[model samples]
Structure formats: C-alpha cells, structure tokens
Target chain A: MVDLTHTLSPEFPFLPVEGKTFPFRSSPIATIKGDGVYANRWELTEHVGTHLDAPCHFAEGAMAIEAIPLETLFVPLAVVSIAERVATNPDTTLGAGDLMRWEKDHGEIPARAAVFLHTGWDVRTKEPGAFVNMDGAKTMRFPGFSDKAIEFLLGRRSISGIGIDTLSIDPGRDKEYAVHKELFRAGKWAVECVANLSRVPATGAFVFVAPVKVAGASGAPARIVAVW
Target chain B: MVDLTHTLSPEFPFLPVEGKTFPFRSSPIATIKGDGVYANRWELTEHVGTHLDAPCHFAEGAMAIEAIPLETLFVPLAVVSIAERVATNPDTTLGAGDLMRWEKDHGEIPARAAVFLHTGWDVRTKEPGAFVNMDGAKTMRFPGFSDKAIEFLLGRRSISGIGIDTLSIDPGRDKEYAVHKELFRAGKWAVECVANLSRVPATGAFVFVAPVKVAGASGAPARIVAVW
Candidate 1:
C-alpha cells in the first residue's frame, strides 16, 4: 500500500487566491486532561492539499463530494510519467501521445481507471514556493494534463477520474482552467497535489480516491492510496 | 463497495459537547459568480461524524492520524451484529461470549481484522436526536463493545482495530470510556459512528479506515469502505 496524500497543514502553500487562501488549520478542541480524550477542530478550504474536486467544483448542479458513488472512487490505477521531460522543462504535461505510449508499453488504459500524471513534482513539495513554482510572482508554472489528454481520456477511454502531483488539473498558468471545466463538465473528479506518484507503477494497482464525506462541498482533503 | 460514512454537515447532530459541538460547517469560499469556480471553506471537529480515533486520542504518546501506517488502515473486516439484542436492549454490548459465538459460526476471527459492532443504529440517522438515543437528560443509550470483547481481540486475536455503529466504541452512557483507553493503550485505532455495518457480511470484506491526513491531529473525519 502506498499513501499518495500530502500531510495537509497550514504550512503547505496554497494556490493563491488574491494573495491568500484558507490553508488547513487545526486547533485543540479537547484534551485527555479535561475531556478525557484528545481531539481537534479544523478549518480549511475544500481544495487545499491532496484533495478531490467534485464535479460541482466547476460544474453547477453536478455531484457533490458525498454524492459520488463509492464504486467510482475505487478505480484501477495508471501512472503516466512526464518526469523526465519535467526535469528539463518545468512546463511539461501528460499529453495524448504520452497516454498512447503508456498503452504501448502496458496495455490499453483500463476501464474505470484513474490516470495520474507523474511529473516528479512531489519532490518540489519539500519547499512551499517550489511546489507551486511561482516565477517572479506573476504566473505559477508546474506540470498538468494537456487539454487534448483530458479529452482523449473522457472521449476515448473508460476512466472514472484523473489526478496529478500538482496544484490543479490544468497547468498552473492556465487562468481559464480549461482542464477543470472539461473534466467536471463530464461529472468526473480530479485529485490534486498528490504526494507519492513516483512510488506507484504505470498500471495494475487498485486506487481509492477518497475525500472527506462533507455534504454538498466542492472538495475536501483526501487520503489517496494504492494497493497492489 | 459500501461507503460506511455519513454525510458530514452542520445539520447532522454532533456528539453534543456541553451546549454545543463544532459540527461540520461549510461556507462558500469561491463561486462561479465570483471566483470562476465553486469552492467552500469547512470547519469541523475531528470526532463529530464517521471518524477514526487514533491511539493518541487518549494515550498521551501514541500515534496521531498521519502516523498510522497505510498498511494498518487496510484490514479484513468482520461485522458482529448485535442488532437483535439492541432492538430490545439498546445498551446491549458485544461481549466476549459474542465473539465465541461468531467464531463458532464463521470460523476464527482472522488476524489483523476490524471487528465492527453492528447495532442497526444507522436506520435512526433520519432523525439526529434518535441516532444517539439520549435517555432523557441522563445518558446516551447505544450499543458498544464489552471490555472483555476488546481485550479478547487485543490479547487473543491479532486485530488492527474495533469499530461501532454508535457514537463511540464504549457505550455512550459509560462516561469513563473504559474501552477507549484499553484499545488505545495497546496502540489500536477505533472507527466510530460508521454508517452501515449491517450491509457487510460476517466476514471476507477488506476494510479501509482512512482519515484526512491532518498533520499531528488526534483524529479526523474518515471515509470507511468495505469491498467484499
């Protein structure tokens, strides 16, 4: 079993929204000394850290996080590595060609599969700013799925969702969020900022993309794992 | 696949704390009208809904939510139903003799299994006040595991955790929480307020008790699932 989730906390940098975002924060709510048990209260934006963006995140009147069928959350895991290219050009993406190449080596992307774009971006998570890769404070640049790749998966394959080791399904500089709209428009979910995509192989593992079962929320921090 | 998680929200009744508990609350942080995408900020206490209680929840220096290994979270599931007894005696417990009867009928309780006490309490979820079954103003009447049953599983059987359909692993009326301390003392976790235990068979299902990967928190809302 491999945990693909980041340890969400206030320290984890956020995809900036007007120079600020509600990062994950924890406060002591109970203690063994007083309440006979230790517990906490948390406040966080639904999209922070390793999380699943429900279709409702962009598609109005779509499935909320709780409405997603449990069977859909359990999918065949497929990792498409663009890490080698990303090492050289930080703006790399998992394109349609990359998916075809993966199929050539493995097999066809299986039905109800979650294809994760592995950009080796997980390494950048050690530093707050590097993970988002904000260049000169103007536009953030990191790897994501190309629009063509998303269309191919939705139109050609039988996948349940797509995931990435970056902040958003669209490239960091994509102000329009083309990929988020495309995927959510199909009523599919997206997993962003996954921690350990490298540890998983190209195919064969069963993945569980589970978010906190928050009723009617856009997204929530998720604990993603793969078991072979 | 069965989702053994309740939809967490403000309307869901919490395990009342004094006059109030920090119930799961969501506020729109972004929207298609304002931020070009829908999103919400959530505030929740760790133990309010379907959740996992880490060993550190009671024991001072035990595992926090993040420290629990992914391998440990995946275990064989065993549902021990006390619903028949609970129909009449709402405070009925799954005791040591119950384990003996279960093993007799279904064979031995396997190693590293999650034995869930199914009290058929999920049907009461339609009315929040009825689910916890607070007896007037005195106690909350609900089924849980006996200390003998917990110790039997801990000392005799090699198990990962114990779970209950009720609000806690110890009966709600037992304010001292004896079962919680006994289980956590041996570094075992607990899954409380699970949604659907009766749906799972007596054995053969693999369980995933996953909580939000909140850094250094005692517990968090969990999305528990079973695949038979």
Candidate 2:
C-alpha cells in the first residue's frame, strides 16, 4: 500500500478563497494537556488536505460522503505518470488528447478504477511558493483536467473517481469549476491534494479513499491510499 | 469495498479537549459559495475523526506515520461484533478472556489481519450525554480494549492493527492509556473512531488504514476502508 495523503500540518498549503478570508489559518491545531494525556485541537475546512469531493460538494441533491457506495471508494487503480509533462510546463492543462496518449502508453482504465493522474506536483510541496504557485496574478495556476479531458474520462470511460496531486482537480485559474461540476454531477468522486502517486504502479493497484462522514456537510478531508 | 468512516457534522461527537477551544465547532470552515465547494483553509490536529496511531503516538523513538511500512496498513481484516455485550453495559471493558470467547464463536484472529472490535458504540454519536458518558466520578465510561486484551492480541496473534468503532481504543475512564503505550511499543498500529463496521463481515475482508505522512507526529486521522 502506498499512502497518498499529505501531512496535515500548518505548513501544508491551502487553496485561496477568492473573496472572504479563510476561516482558519493553515496551521496545526494546538495540543491541550488533558488531566493526564494531551489531546490535539485545531481549525480546518472539510475540503482541505487530502480530501474527497462528494456529489453534493458541487451539485445539489447529489450523494454526500455517507451516501457514496462503499464499493466505489475502493477499486482497481491506475496511476498514469504525467510528471514529465507537468515538469516541462508547470501550468500545463490536461485535455482528452493527453489522456489518450497516456492510455496508449498504459492500458485502458478498467471500469470503476481510480484513474490517478500522477503529475509529480507534490515535490513542490517542500517549497512553499512552488506548491501554492502564488507568483503573478491573484489566481494560482497548476496542471488540472481540462473540460474535454473530464468529459472523456467520466462520460466515455467507466471510472469511480479521479485522484490528483495538485490542490484541486481543476486549474487554479478556473473560475467556473466546470470540470468539478461535471464530475460530481456524474455521480463520480475526486481525491484532491494526494501525495506520492509517483510511488504507485501504473496499473493493477486498488485505490482506497475514505472520507469522514460529516452529516449533511458538503465535503471533508480524507486519507487516500493505494494497495496492490 | 466499504467506507467505514462517520460523517463529521455538528451532530457527530468529538473527543472533548480540556483547553484551547478555538476549533472543533460544528462547522469550522465556510462553504465555498456558488461553487458547492466547502472549506479552503486547513485546520485541526493530526489526530481527528477517523484516524490511525503510529507507534510514536505513545512510545518514544518509535515509528512515525510515514516511517511505518505499507504492508502493515493494508492487511486482511476480521471484525468481531460485541454489540450485544455493549448494549448491556456501555462501560464493559473487553479483556483477554472476552477476546478468547469471541474467537471461539467466530474463527481465530487470522495472522497479519487487523482485528476490528465492533461494539456498536457509534449509535450514541448524536447524543452528547451518551456519547461522552460524563455522568459520575469516572467522567466517562464506554466500551474499550483492556490492558489484558492488548497484551494477548499483540503477544499471541500475528496482527497488524486494532480498530474500534468507539472514540478511543482505551475506555474513557482509563488514566494510564496502557493499551496505546503497549501496542505501539510492541510495533502495532491502531485505528480509532471507525464507523459502519456492521456493514462488513467478520472474515475475508481487508482493512485499509492509511495515516497522513506527518513527518514526526505521533498519530494522524485516517480514512479507513474495508474490502472483501
């Protein structure tokens, strides 16, 4: 099994909120001394860290974390390494053409398999600037699934979810979030901010994602793993 | 594949901290407007919700979350239902003898399998009084693994981790937390606050527990799943 969750430390980067200030700082919770043992406490948004997006997160009347079928959470997984492309162009966008090339190299994505796009964006996590990519315009820019890529994967192929190493499945500059809407509307899930996809196999592994059941909440931080 | 995680809503119970109450509110982060997205900021301690305990959680110089081998996290799993006993006594403390009785009823604890103790304690999650059980001098009293139980399970059986549906592996009244210390010291890991164990069978299932790669943190919350 390969762990694909990032450390939930304060130092881990957080997605920028366009308008309002983020409720909690991207920092570790405090460890309070109990009568004897210590208990940790901190502020966090459900969608931060390595997390899963339920259909309700982007579409109304859609499945919540609890409503997602357990079978869909763990399935055969394919980790297609897009690291070289991402390395060549940090702001690269993945379209259906790119996925086709990957499918040519890797076998077809089996039904209900988690198609993990390993872009090697996680290495930037060590460097704050690169990880967040907050250089020029107010918006951040990182590789993400283009509209056509998401359509081809969710509509054409039978996939349970999409897992990515970057902060979101959509490009940081995407204001409309069409890819996210389409995926969730299709009743599929997405795993965000996953780490160590580079360590997993290109095929034949099973991806296991378990999100906390936050009652009626849109989404929650989750720990995603891959087992052969 | 089964999702064994409880949703984190205002209704879900959390381990009450003694001090520093800045977080842990019903909704810590704001929901992203018009996007159906929720929470952009990161907050909370490594140990929150459905989570895992690395050896370092209690013992000094023990394995960190990342340092723990992958083989240990994804192993065969066995769920031993004790809901009958817990219904009679929420304070019931499971000992070595109890475990033996369970093994006699259900087959033996398989080698290298995670033994999930299902007490059905999660029903009280919405009731603070029943969930916390802070009634008498004991402050709290709920089903948990006894010291004797940990000793036998770790010393005799070839197991990877112990998972429980309760908030903590040890009973709420436990002062020394011997179970946590001994298990970690002995190189075993644990999963706490798991939900939906009833949805899984007693055997032929695999427990998928993955902790976040927090550099040197003692423990981190996990998204645990069971695959049959």
Best by lDDT: 1
lDDT of 1 by residue, A1-228 (tens): 899998988898788887336567888877878877788888888889899999998887899999988888999999999999999998877889999999999999999999898998887876988987889968999988999999999999988998999898898888888998999989889899998888988898999988989889888889999989
Query: What is each candidate's fraction of native interface contacts (fnat)?
Result: 0.92, 0.51
> Which runs in model 2 stand beyond 4 Å of their true positions?
A18-36, B20-23, B26-48, B64-66, B104-107, B212-216
| Docking verdict class for candidate 2 | acceptable
The per-model lDDT (C-alpha) reads 0.87, 0.75
Which candidate number would show the highest TM-score if scored against the true structure?
Answer: 1
Q: What is the total number of backbone clashes in candidate 1?
A: 0
DockQ of 1: 0.79
Cα lDDT of model 2 by residue, B15-97, tens digit: 66554322235542445464455543334555666778777666667787768787888889988777888898887877889
Candidate 1 per-residue C-alpha lDDT over B71-110 given as tens digits, one digit per residue, 9 for 90 to 100: 7789999899989999999878888999999999999998
- Deviation (Å) of B179 in candidate 2: 2.4
